[model samples]
Target: MTKNKIEKIFKILSKQISNPKTELTYKNPYTFLVSVVLSAQATDKSVNASTVKLFKIIKRPEEMIKLGETKLKKYIKTIGLYNSKAKNIINLSKILFEKHNGKIPSDFNLLTSLPGVGNKTASVYQNEILNIPRVAVDTHVFRVSNRIGLVKTKNPDETQIKLESIIPKKWLKSAHHLLILHGRYTCKSQKPLCGDCVVYKHCSYIKSEQNKKNISSQ
Candidate 1:
């Protein structure tokens, strides 16, 4: 997209949701990291449900370690990929305690090195907790960006790079949340609510639909 188009898209999305935030519930950065880890291939509602009771007991890294892998698995088993997530969380907490003095690392490489934290999760940690201008391209961001003509890419990694390259710097921080909310509510995978979409005019998917309708009418 052109610079002017990018700016316009950012302006519209920003106006729609001024202060977008992660739906995952957490008290501190440590808990937030764990929540993001558990959120891989999982819904925020599901993560929140699991964390609600889990967080009450395991607030700090030490507490999480104390809970142990077996106990952690019990709390998170309801979530998909619970066994591995439990191990990662426990191991990551130990690293946080030993290395970072119980603080989440700010550096992306260091963050990604932790168990269960990939590029997307690291970006989320920086964006939500640290307020950094990094767009974490989750499934929602990927689908919404492609639908809205913001980025046309095959996978999440390519989508993230495309978005980082094009999206205005001012909108970087809230971009993930805005795109996520859009996909979750409007531009859904199964049935996008094109009739009510705020950016329907600029949406490539909707334009394609309109073209089909026009052709059929002819």
Candidate 2:
């Protein structure tokens, strides 16, 4: 897509949901990192519900290690992959304490090296916390970007690369949230709300549907 079109798409999305931010409730970077780890293949609502009580008591890495993996799993049992995620969280917390002095590292490589902190998680932490312009392509981003003709990629990594290359730097910071919200609410996987979508005009999915309708009518 062209620079102007990309800007228009994001501007409209931003207007719809002003000050778009992560739905995961957390007190600090430590909690945010844990939430992202728990959010793998899980919903933000689920993560928030799980973290609500947990965050009140144990909001730091050292505290998490003290909580132990078993207790951590019990706290996040509602989320998917609770057992493995709990282990990763505990292991990562130990690393945070031993290496970074319980602070979340700003470096992407260092962040990814942590257990459960994949590319998507690292990008999310960087974007929200560090204000880095990294497009974290989750399922929503993958579907929405392709549907909107923003990128014609196969996987999340490809989508991320294409998005970072094409999307204007000005919109990069907010693009992750904008695209994610648009996909989650408007451009859904099963039945998209095309009529209600603000960027329907620019959506290739809508255009394709129109073409099909025209062909059928003809």
Candidate 3:
């Protein structure tokens, strides 16, 4: 995307949500990390439904270790991949206590090295907790960026790199939230509300015209 388009797009998004935050609810960094891990392929509402009770009992790594994998699974069973997620969360919490002195590591490599933590999850942890300027591209950011001509990439990692390079430093922190909210509310995968989209003029997706036609027909 051009510099002007990027700026304009971000400006519109920022105005819509002055302070955008992750929908996943957590009280601290450890809980936040756990929440993001559970959020993979799961809705925030589902994760929150489980974590609201999960966090109350185990807010810290030591607490999570006390909970154990078998028991943790009971709480997160509603989320997809809960069996493995529970195992990873339990093991990762143990590592946090043993290796990191019961603290969530701020370093990306260290964070990613933990069980169940990948690039996307690590970026989210660092960006939200440590105030880093990394773009953690989820499905929302990936689809919206492509549709809006921000990046012509095949995957989230490449799209994240492209966005970080092109997105102005001023908007870097909020880019993830902006793109995500836009996708969730406006530029959805099916039946994107193009007429209501703030960046409709900047979108490059040919399907948007068809969407407008479909809407008008209705």
Q: Is candidate 1 or candidate 3 better by TM-score?
A: 1
Which runs of model 2 end up more than 4 angstroms from their true locations? 216-218
Models 1 onward score TM values of 0.95, 0.97, 0.94
Tens-place lDDT digits, model 2, residues 28-49: 8899988888999999999999
Prediction RMSDs, each to the true structure: 1.3, 1.1, 3.0
Give the range of the ten consecutive residues with the poorest summed lDDT in model 2.
Answer: 72-81
Would you list the clashing residue pairs of candidate 1? none
Off by over 4 Å in 3: 206-218
For each candidate in the order shown, give its overall lDDT on alpha carbons: 0.90, 0.92, 0.90
Tell me the tens digit of each residue's lDDT in model 1 across 1-218. Answer: 68898788778877877777889999899999999999999999999999999999988999999999999998998899999999999999999999999888899999999999999999999998888888899998998898888888999999988898888888888888989988888789899988887787777887888889999999
Give per-residue CA lDDT, model 3, range 1-218, as digits (tens): 57988899899889988888788899999999999999999999999999998888888999999988889999999999999999999999999999999999888899999999999999989888999988999999999999888889999999889999999999999899888888988888888888888777778885666688899999
After superposing candidate 1 on the true structure, give the runs of residues whose Cα lies further than 4 Å from its correct spot.
Answer: 215-218
Clashes of 1: 0
Clashes of each: 0, 0, 0
